[model samples]
Target: MSLPDIKEALNEYEFKWKAEQVTIQATLLKEHSDGRVTGDITITTQAKEYHPHIHQSQFNFSAGRTRETLAKTLHSRVPDLISLKQWEDIIEQLCVKIVAMIREGEPALELAIDDTKNIPPEYLLEPILLKGLPTIIYGEKGANKSTLSILFSICMLLPWKDNPLGLVCPTRSIKSLILDWEQDKEIVQYQAKCLKDGMNLPYFDVYYRHCARPLANDLPQIARNISKVGAEVIIIDSLGAACGGELNKPGPALDFFAALRELRIASIILAQTSKDTESKKKTVFGSTYFTYYARSVFELVKADEIDKTSSDIALFNREANYSARHDPIGFHLTYNGTGIMVQRQDVNIGQFIKRHSTQQAIYEVLKRGAMKPKEIAKETGENENAVRVALSRMKAAGKIVMTDQGYGLLSKDIMQ
Candidate 1:
């Protein structure tokens, strides 16, 4: 009948509460003659002061119900009366507590086991440039490095068949962005026209930002633009012009690469080689950081007897982290009447001649008839030991046969 009497009756119930800062107060509001009790409960939080945080809600129970039953009923129903904002605040507090617990190392780290087989690296060009990885294409001045970079961009932007360099595009189509900091708008436009006309495409899926702001200062905007265009691959033409500080310095170089990694897109960074550095290792014009961070590195060098402006160029795979180094591939950047075009030479004479000179000489000598190793060496003017090595290799490759008379071509069908 009285509030104190009702409180005393409810205190006998063994109701376990989870929140130490919260309290519930129940009052008997009415008593029905047919042995029913109607009441309301007020839920509040207690600090130094009591704060009514939840709206009061009615509860009904039979007169004969035990304190345990009443407490349990109230416990279950009180949560429903809490406001949405109160619930959100409670969840935020719990999250903060959980974060603190984690920081205190209450829970051990979790390990996830993946049963899937290891996947191979995905590449734009097999063994050369991988998807979602950074690559550096560096060359001496006038090596047509920009042309090569443009070719790559064109390949990625247009249909695979339109790719003049014959690079394999894993996807049906790829959107590419070219941030050309070195070239002017007119030059870039001309180059783009040439690529479009040469590929015989009305237009390409490529976007170009000719002569962009320096990379060091405008990385955020560049990253946003890449995302805005949904670019799968981005090319930064000429790292020196894009970068703000000296490229030879580690701080600037690292910062530049860090910005690139943040874009999370496959990137090709074009750079110039230092003069007087003929060797591939020293030619990359920046700090070792560039090579260290790059997933692959390629060098383009002008072939001997070729004019600096000539289309003939040699591409050498200097580094490949995911795949074996590919032999140098020859590319000619010729201009048709309509546009500039790149064509892969049928034969990579530089690599072919370097790797197979002895084999070629031996084969030429054997073209006439079978001959002993000494006779082959004397006829070909090759070292006797070298001839023996070449003969052994050729024999194992089924290119040649040794009979009682001498060694001879296994089949005349072999190409010279």
Candidate 2:
């Protein structure tokens, strides 16, 4: 055989032979300047069939030693050195050895009782995202999911005195990376300018990549980039575009998230709600695996009382595994000449609309004139019982009064 072939054969034999014994190994450490090979030929087996006192013997070859000479030297000293066959067989045997070793011992299941308390979750956005876990934000088209995600990224990147979302963050400023598959260069440039100007920060630490590759193919490269930049947070805009495979299938979904887990960076994945009304779930647009693997899930929807054209949005904490679900938060999206801007609005809007719907209906009807509960209910299209309950609450609040006819706004409070 040629010198290169002989060297390959010797290397293959070393690896395969080591696996059969408990502590036997042959390693080529280095080549000396004068053409001598220096390495260890160790034998740990206590078997009497092998030579005694050959525990960890070092072999230093003289200058100009050929591969055949090295192989002969190794074969003479090491007992039962296997010969290399086809490359496929070598690979197959290596795989088998690995599996056998892995299955050789059972793992311990007990935990140490003396260990300290478990670490509390570190929040990038408290109650919404934990530092080491994955978070997903889902909404229908035009629900501002991407805008909200961008806003969150900016908040994490900026050194704000107060929490931008009115939520808690463990750190004031975080290095963030946004892998946007949806937006173009112009849009992202505009967004960066907006965040920088709006926050009045001279500089921001967030990084952006307008990604075109699928998660499966690009995860390794993405991970290297993140590590190179030392990013603490990453956002994958619109999970569908990044997945590159049928998300409804379990294999691809699991694979995508598995890749994310391996990345070890806190992630925020944007997703869409199913266009088909009949197929829509409380979770995201695709397979349930998206929600199953996510640490937290949030949903964005159009505000009920707010007009769609008004650019109002409501954010709901659909799922939060680490903490209790938070109340719905509201936001107003508007372009501030740089990019789409997210302004936090009243968080109590959802609750207020639900709790005061009947009362507001009654108040509007009573503005015309005093009317009985049945008449008010008819005019407002609310249940009579609901109208009565609302009237009682409204009267107690001094916003309305019980008159001889029915109910009317308190004079002092009216026309104000």
lDDT of 2 by residue, 89-193 (tens): 333343334334323434679877777988778887766679879998888777767667767776666645375467665556787788989997677666667
Tens digits of per-residue lDDT for model 1, 119-199: 888887554468899988887777777767777766665546535565675565677788988876677777778877875
**Stretches of candidate 2 exceeding 4 Å from the true structure:** 1-119, 277-282, 303-310, 339-341, 347-416
Winning model by TM-score: 2
Q: Against the unseen true structure, what C-alpha lDDT does each candidate score? A: 0.64, 0.65
Q: Once model 2 is optimally superposed onto the true structure by TM-score, how far is the C-alpha of residue 269 displaced, in angstroms?
A: 0.5
Task: Evaluate model 2: give its TM-score.
Answer: 0.59
Which pairs of residues have clashing backbones in candidate 1?
none
Task: Give the 10-residue window scoring lowest on summed lDDT in candidate 2.
Answer: 1-10
Off by over 4 Å in 1: 1-114, 162-164, 211-213, 277-282, 304-310, 346-416
What C-alpha lDDT, on a 0 to 100 scale, does residue 95 get in candidate 2?
35
* Candidate 2 lDDT score relative to the true structure: 0.65
TM-scores, one per candidate: 0.57, 0.59
